[model samples]
Target: MKLSELGEIGFLKKIEASLPLSDKSVLLGIGDDAAAVRVSRGKTLLSTTDLLTEGIHFDLKYISFYQLGAKALLVNISDIAAMGGIPRYALIVIAVPDNIKVAELNELYRGIKKTASSYKVSIIGGDTSGSKNSLTINITLLGEAKQGNIVSRGGARPGDKIFVTGTLGDSSAGLELLKKGKRSGYLIQRHLLPAPRVKEGVFLSKNRLAASMIDVSDGLATDLNHICEQSKVGAIIYEDKIPLSKELKKAKLKKSPLNYALSGGEDYELLFTVKASYIKKVYNAISKGRLSATMIGEITEMKKGMLIVDGKGQKMPLLPTGFNHFR
Candidate 1:
């Protein structure tokens, strides 16, 4: 069957099922956004890559070249964040359409360099090529974590508390507003220049806080489902507990803001779990980033099932509407 017909998640499942078992050096592979491996004594290596094609992942008419470049790097950085690793180097491959000006390309490079500098990562090497159609960017990022500090999606336990960094749905709202050509600065900037929660990730790892973790790249519902599936657990999220920005709350909309908060993508925040004993510390540790972590739910045994409670105290199954990638 064709990929379009199969859909992104279905296509990915087929690819994953067909792949061979990872080598011994590979600590984690295929299923997660990033892969990790044993690199050296007392240090494990983390690597992730992503691709962005013009007219697909982004549209040139609305976004600046600089923001595109920064976002390209930031997406990869977010994968590293999911693993609680310190990013060290990057390799970027670019396919440029000849019609694009050299000066504009330079501005793109400037943005990439500036973001790398802020993260203390170096652009080590990559390939450049000419594209016959449009611009394409592929980036491979490398990071490291202390051998004992690494966390994965498979570590959550029943009764663990679920927490997330910053607000949700802002980026999704930002994109919708951007498409309408509305002028909300924070929303537009979020859709354009979303920040990775690197420091927050590091704090969680170093302090031994999060039992399992993943970034909110694909939205809270989808990403949290990743953790639950890998860990063989269930969850219950409270509708009123989800952190929605004032912009999203006040905006005139067709759907509930809670729907966007649950299903919206591109927030770039961290969704993590912690044992009940350490839940208080999770809240205390997040102040380093000037944002508070919100506890939305608790992990439960798989048979208990995944659910969300609404404002009227009604309970229902929490089905994820996050994967618009296929629909």
Candidate 2:
């Protein structure tokens, strides 16, 4: 009835019952330090990990166990997608609170299963343990990409156009609405389920269009600076060019929409760079989908530093306003 009675093993048994492990390559699932898998020749492996804590990363009062589980894994998949890779496997390490119900744990695993299945990835192995005060989920995802197809944060060149997939500020808008006890269908959905742009990443990698790429886990301003710092370049972003979502427009938080779009985190959209010459091709490819890529800025020489131009056409130094552990 209660979690303390069922214990970790019992909870794991219930969760494992529904896992359909059809892939023969998955030699082990849900019971080890790591999942062992056979890799095909000539493909490079991409590995990423993310940790979610109860009070820090989420508030259980507003988030469902299923959503918590789904989000824990999907966010790591987003990292692989940013590198232009296909996710193949995952290992989940969960810290459970003694008071959490066995039924709740099962619901969490169901969400994890749904997310992994949606991405065609297998949960090969994991570990479970008891924590004193809160629940924590740590997930490591492994993926593969062609040797030369992998994108990184250090490849941007001066004159390349900066583009982002989909409109921004929706997740932050959703958070704002949630905090105010107001409901906007789009914002709520955006917060609950943020889509990773895997197909778009693959398209960019295949076309050789993305010189550098990073996902908008931190706000656009912070993530873009990551590319600039790594590439040893500077950037100039135009305030008017950044795409703001319809939900953000409707929410109309006291802060300007541009501020939310630029500084609010958890958007999960892709931020990428393309040479000016290939912009047309990139635009054409994304046009086929409902999602539109907006070009908001350009890479510049290192001496220029990162700058943002306001509506008055006055340029100002851009500060990192995105998520930082220390700040």
Candidate 3:
């Protein structure tokens, strides 16, 4: 049946069923004018929102509604993970075109429900509306972290060492493969369902290991640039030090793996810095988290600027050439 027949309330009833049960943190959820939550003393909350559009951020032809729904939530959760917080609740607002079916939207809700439950997050509330154009999903996620445990992109010092949680370029490489009709399993999934580095973020934050942190949503070059901009420092990354997935390495594409590693957006891995003194302890801590990361670079004075060191130790200017929304 068409959405006009089901109307807003009818569709929302379907979405409500897909949500997880109430938790202690959630004081009130759907059916109210607004959702409410309670928090512990001495803790800070982290909030982030993202907009996913049909042609801009995603394409409906290649992306299933279910995957789109999961991804719509996952990307926002990545922001919380970047700050070393535990995701708790979310408010999703979706706008759908008339041509869309109720089944498609329910599948999308299934995707959202599965992801939220996995992260132990509650879907407190959201709004759905009819759209004249493309399908759109907007999610606002809230997470909490102890005051001291909240990591930011601006904490890096001059001598801090830069590191990344997982291999880079996989998602971007995967996207390229899909566009070319190449069905490499892992690569495509990496692009379709990128995993957030929540565990690593929490471990490092709790242990006071990371000096600065940010997720590689817009690729290593761009995200690292954000840290530098916020901290007022420059960085030098070694070409050989960047971790590239085997799948990305094996992909036959027009762009080099290094280029993908440098400019590919949506990796969702954490890129962080640790003080030189804490490098060893950080290594041990990450071992306990079962995450392997590489020390790719170091923070330097602002005058030194961002550059990439080649294998032979040649330094070249590294442009912030990752995915740009307006470009």
Q: What is the TM-score of each candidate against the true structure?
A: 0.94, 0.86, 0.87
Model 3: what TM-score?
A: 0.87
- Cα distance off (Å), candidate 1, residue 78: 1.1
Q: What is the lDDT of residue 100 in candidate 3?
A: 96
lDDT of each: 0.86, 0.82, 0.84
Question: How would you encode candidate 3's per-residue C-alpha lDDT over 148-197 as one tens digit per residue?
Answer: 78788888889999999789998888887778876658988988888988
lDDT of 1 by residue, 1-327 (tens): 766688777777789889977588888887775788888887899999989899778888778889889999999998898898989999999999999999889989988999999899899999999999999999999999987888899899999999998889888777778788775577678888989989888888988898999988877888888888889999998989998888788877666678777888888898999999997676665555443689999999999778898889998998756854555
- Could you tell which candidate, 1 or 3, scores higher by lDDT? 1
Q: Pick the candidate with the highest TM-score.
A: 1
- Badly placed stretches (over 4 Å) of model 2 are 1-41
Residue-by-residue lDDT tens digits, candidate 2, 1-327: 877777544575678777868986544344221233435655666778888999877888767899889988888888888888888899999999899999999999999999999999999999999999999999999987776777788889999999998888788778777777764478867776788888888888877899999889878888888788778999999998888876677776778788878888788899999998898888787677733689999999999999999989999998778765523
lDDT of 1 at 325: 55
Worst 10 residues of 1 by lDDT: 283-292
Give one clash count per candidate, in the order shown. 0, 2, 0
